[model samples]
Target: MMASIQKRPNGSWRARYRDDEGKEHARHFDRKIDGQRWLDGVTAGMVTGTYVSPAAGKVTLTAFYLIWAERQVWETGTRRAMDLSVRSCSFEGVELRALKRSHVESWIKAMSAAGLAPLTIHGRVRNVRSVLRAAVRDRALSVDPSEGVSLPRKRRADMAMDIPTPEDVRRLYDGAEDWFRPVVALAAFAGLRLGEVNGLQLADINFLPRTISVLRQVQRTPGMAIEIRSPKYGSERVIPVADSLLLILSAHVENVGVYGDDNWILPGRDGGPIWPRTIAYHWDRLTARLDLNGVRLHDLRHFYASGLIASGCDVVTVQRALGHRSASVTLNTYSHLWPNADDRTRSASQSLMDGALAIPADSLRTAGA
Candidate 1:
C-alpha cells in the first residue's frame, strides 16, 4: 500500500497508510523526513511478511498465557509444572511487545541471586520462552525477545549421577516393611520408575514368560485425583525378569495374595493405588530410620543401569532394557559406566597379535640352543 504524507494544520507532518485489513494508522512527526522513514519501515515490514499489528501485543504476558494455556494439550502434571515455571520468572505484567532481552537477563540474575539452581533458572526461562514464541507465531509480537540470552552454567558435580551400592540396596530392602519390599525390588532390580511401579497391575506381569510389561504410569497433581496414563513417551516396554527378581516377585505374590489379575500389584492400605506423596513419606521415614543419608529412591534405577553396563550390555540393549527413547539418551547418562573404547581396542589388538604370532614348541627349543 502507498503511504501518504501531508502537512497537518498545526504545522506538523502526518504519515498515514492502510494495512492489509484496510485499517488506517497515522503518526504525527515534527519533520516530513522522520514521518517518511517511519512509514517506509512499516511498509517494508508488510512487504517482507513480517508486519505485526500495533495493537495486537497490548496484552500482558500473564493475560496472553491464560488464553494460550487453555489451548494446550498438556497433561495435568505438566500443566501444573508449566504454570509454576511461568510464575517463577516474574514476567507476568510485561506486555508481549514490551518484552526485551534485558527483562529476561534480569530475571535470570534475580533467580541466580535468590539461590535457585541453574537448571531451575533455565527451566523457568524456557517456559517463558515458549509463551513468547507462541506470541510470535500468533502475530502478537514481531520477534521473540528471549532468544540468545545467556543462561547460567550448571555445575559439573550437579550433573554427576551416583549409583547405590549393593549393601545400600540390601539394607533398605531388609529394613523396609514386607509390603514395601516389592517397591524397592521393582526399582532396584527391574528399573521401573516410581510412577511406573505405582501403576503396575497383576495383568502386566507375565510369570509364564518371566517378563514385566510397562504400559502405564500413575501421575498426581495437587488438588486432583490420581490419574493412570500411558508410560512416559516411548517408555512402554517389557523387561525380561532375572531369576533373582523373579523369586522376589513370586514370594511377594504368594505372601501378599493376588487380589485379582486386574488389581494393582502394589495397592495402598485402603486397596487403592499408592499415592506418590505417600510413597515419598514412607520412603523418607524408612531411609532416615536406616541412617541412609543422601540416598534417593531414584538412585535405585541408576543402580539397575550400572548393572546393565557392567554386564557388557551394548548401547541399544541397555537403552531398550531401561526404556529410554533413544540410544543417545542411554549413552549420555551411562557413558561413564562403560569401559573405555581405547581399552577395548587395545585388548582386541593384543588378542589378534597373539593368535597371528604363535610359535611352535620346537621353534622355541631351537631358539634356546
Candidate 2:
C-alpha cells in the first residue's frame, strides 16, 4: 500500500493511494486535515486487506450507472421509469468521483424546466441520490455532493377535484356495471380501500351481522400482474355495514354466482383474483357513462368519510371506518366536510343580545325608575 499527498493547480489538496492490485485512487479535499483524515482511513483499510477502491473516478458516469442498474431489481413499471430517466440525460464520459454539486443542481433545474411535475422530479432526484449514496458507502468518493440537496416542493391539488359527493357516488353506482355497482357502494358506504375491496372473500362478509372483515388486499404490479397482499400497514380491521349495503351485498353474492369458501368475492371474469386496475377501468367507464365530473375511484372512500361526518359521526369514528393510521389524518383531510361553527356562533350572539335587551321592563322599572 502507498499513500501520497498532492496539491492541485486549483489549490485543492488531493490524497492519492495505491491498493494491492496497483490500482491508483485519488480523492480531493478542501482542507489538508480532511485529506489527511481520508488517508488515515485508507491506511487502516489497506492494513486489514479490506480495501476496495470504488475506482469510480476512473470510469465514465454512464458506465458506472450501467453497473449500478445491473444491481437493481426494480419492478416492471419502476424499471421502465428508471430506464426513461437514465436515457433522458447524457452522463457519458463524466467521471463519477468528480461529480460536483452544481452538476446535480443543474440537472434538477433542467428537469424542472422540462415541465415535469414536482412529484416526478422528486422521484427522479431521489433515485439518483440513492445511487450516489451507494457509491459513497462503497468508498467511491470522499464525500457525496448530492447530500443535503433540496428538490422542488410538491403542491397538493385541490381535494374537491378528487373527492366525490354522496350524490355523485349514487350517480356513478346507477351507471356502473352490475358486477361493479356493489363494489362502489361498499367503497362509498363502508370506506373500504380498493385493495381491501378486491381482496374480500365471500366468507369475510356477514350479512346477518352487517359487518365485513378486512384481512388482505389485492394489488396489481406495474406490469398489470395481480397478487394479494395484506392491508395497508398490515392491520386487520372490521367495519360495520349499513342495513341497505348489507341487503345489496347479499343480492350481489347470489346474483354473481356464490363463491367457494376459499374464493374471493370479486373475481375477474377468468375466475382469478380481481386487479385494482380493473376496478379503476370500470370506474372510468361508469363515470363517463354517468357524466360525473372530477371523481376518482379512491374518492369513494372520501365520500364515505364525508357521509359519516355529515351524519354527525365523530372524527375518531371516521378514522376507524377509513382504517386511517391516526385520527389526525382523517381530521386534517376531511375537516371541511364538518359544518363551520361560525354560523352557530353568530346565531348565539344574536340571541344573547336579544335576551339582554328584552330583560322584562317591569323588573327594570322596579329596580331603577
Candidate 3:
C-alpha cells in the first residue's frame, strides 16, 4: 500500500512509505503540493515496484569500503597493504553503485599520471575489484563496475641478482654485531625469509641433528599489531642447519635461556616477538659498515639460491630447500643464475671432429697419392 501525507504541528507536510523490504522512510516537504507530488510518485513506484530509496542509492564509496574491510580475511601485512591502497585511492567519496567502468579506468589513469608503477596500479585495481566483487555477492549491486578493467602491461624491474660474492658475505658477517651475526648467517646460509626467522621457536630447532623446521611466519600490520600465521600452503618442511648457524643458535640459546615454554628462539629485549624492521635496520648498519651494496634483507634468500646453483645443487633440491610449491617458480626466479649450457657445444664439436677425421700424420703424407 502507498503512504499518505500528514501535516505536523510545526506546519511541515511529511509523506511516509514502506519499501519492498517493509522498512519505513519519511520525506518532509515545505509545500503541500510538493509533498503531494512526492506521494503521487511513491504511489506510482509502489504500484510498479520500482521504488528504491534515496539512502540506498546514495551509499558513499567510503561506507562500502568500511563494510568491505570489516569482512576481509587476510594476513596482517596483506590487510595493511590493502588498507593503504584504499586510503590512497582517488575515488573515495563517489557513490559506489553509481560507479561506472569509465570511472575505474579514469582512476587507474590518474594513478599512472601520478607516476605510480604499473605493479602498484595493478595492486590498487585488485583491491578495488575485491571490494566490488563482495558488493556483488552481497546483492548490493547488480554487477561489479570494476570488472573487465584493463591495466597497463607491467615492466619487470631489474631483479637483485648481484648477490654478494663470498668474500663480501664473509666481511659483512665478521663485522656484524655478535647477536645479529647469527641472524644474517641463517638467512644467507639457510635461505629463511624474514618472517620465518622471526617466527622461529626453540622446538623448531634441532640442535642434536642440526635442522630447522619452517612452520609459521610472523607479520606486523600497519598499527604494529603482530600476527602469526601458518607458512604459505601450511608447508612444514625441515632444512639442514648450517654448521655456522647451529653454533650461533646454541650460544644464543645458552645466553638468553629458554625464556618460556612457548619456545620462541628469537624474542625482543622484554621477551616478546622481534620486530622485522629492527632486523633490517641492524642489517643495513652492518652493510654500511662493510661498505657493501645496500642489499635488501629479502635478497639474502636470493643469495642462498645463487650459492646453491653455483655449487652444483640441482633446481629440484633448491626448490625443496626454499619450500617453493613448484619447481617452475624456483627455475624461473633463479634461471639467470644458472650457467649457460650453450657454452658446452664446443666440447661436443671437438669429439665429433675427432671421430670424423681419421687422417693421422702418415695418412696426411699419402694424401697426394
Candidate 4:
C-alpha cells in the first residue's frame, strides 16, 4: 500500500509510510497540504518503479561500481584498462541516486581537458555509464545520468592500428633474444595476434603446404588462471608463411627441443602456455632498450599489414590474411598504408589516354598542311 497522511490530536499532520517488511516510517509536518504532497510523490514514485528505501541513495557510486565490476567477466587487458579508467574517475564518490547529467558532463570536460585521447576518454566514460546503467536496472538509481551525455566520435587513431616501419621491426627482431626471435618474426610476418602466437604448437605448422593453421588462442582469466580460448573474433584461419619466416620458424623449432605435436611452441616454465602480459613485459623492456618509442608488440601485426600493402596485396587479400571478420576492418585499419595507390590511379588514367582512339590525327594533319 502507498503512504497515508493523518492529522494528529495536536493539529499537525503525521505522514506514515510502510516498508516492504511491514516496518513503518512517520514524519510530522506543520501543514496537512505538505503531508498530502509528500504522500502524492511517494505514490508517483511507486508508479514509476523508482520507489526504494530512502537509504538506497546512501550507497556511493564507487562502492557499487566495484560490486558491478567484480561480477563482470572481462579479458585481462580490458580489466586493466577499466581499472585504470575507474581509478582516475573523480566522480565515483557521489551518491548513486544523486548523480546528475551535469556532474557527468563536467567530469567528461575535465577528462578531455586533461589531454586524454578521445578513445581513452570514451573508454573511461563507457565504464562509468556501464555502472550507472546497472544501478538504474537494479533500482538503486531512478535514472542514469550518463544518458544524453555526448561521447567522442571515433577517428582513425581510435579505430586504426598504428604501424611501425620495416626498419623499426627489423631492429626489434634483430635485438631480441634467440628464444624470442621466432615469436617476433612470426608476429611481424604472419600477422598473428599475441594470443594466437602463444597458442601455437608444432602440429599447427605445415612445411610442405607452407601454411600455418590458427585454431586457438591462450588468455588469462580474471582469476589469474591460464586458459585456452578461441582467437579473438574466432578468426580461425590458415596463414601462408613467407620463405624467410619459414626458415626462422624451422630454426626455432629445431632449437626448442622436447616438442610434441600438442606442445606449446613458446611454453612457460610450467610447460604450459605463457600469458600475453609476459610477452608485453619483455616487449616493453626491448622497445626501451632499442629506443623504439610508441611501438608495441601488437604493432608487429600492423607491420605485417604494412608489408602486405607494400607488396600490392588488395584489401580482400589482407583481410583474409589477417583473419579479419570483414574486408572493411582491414580497410579501416590500413587504408592509409596502401603503397602507391594515388600514383597507380594517376598512371592508370594516363595509360587509358595513351590507348585511346586516334581521333586527333585528322586535326594534326590539317595543322601541318
> lDDT (0-100) at residue 254 of candidate 4?
84
Better of 1 and 4 by TM-score: 1
In model 3, the worst 10-residue window by lDDT is 155-164
Q: Model 3 over residues 54-74: C-alpha lDDT tens digits?
A: 565477666877877887666
Mark the regions of model 4 whose C-alpha exceeds 4 Å error after superposition: 1-3, 14-29, 32-55, 76-84, 105-118, 150-161, 170-178, 206-247, 255-262, 274-294, 306-369
Off by over 4 Å in 1: 20-22, 47-50, 157-159, 259-261, 325-328, 349-369
Query: Residue by residue across 314-356, what tens digits does model 4's lDDT show?
Result: 9999998899989988877877776566888986776676589
The candidate that achieves the highest TM-score relative to the unseen native structure: 1
Tens-digit lDDT track of model 2 for 73-143: 65444566666665555453557766788877888888889899888888877766666666666555555
TM-score, structure 3 vs. true? 0.67
List the global CA lDDT of all models: 0.85, 0.75, 0.76, 0.81
Each prediction's total of clashing residue pairs, residues at least 3 apart in sequence or on different chains, is: 0, 0, 0, 0
The CA lDDT at 250 in model 2 is 80
Best by lDDT: 1
Give each model a TM-score: 0.87, 0.65, 0.67, 0.69
Candidate 1 residue-wise lDDT, 62-109, digit = tens:
888889999998777768878987887667788877888898889889
Preferred candidate (TM-score higher): 1 or 2 = 1
Task: Find the number of clashing residue pairs for candidate 2.
Answer: 0
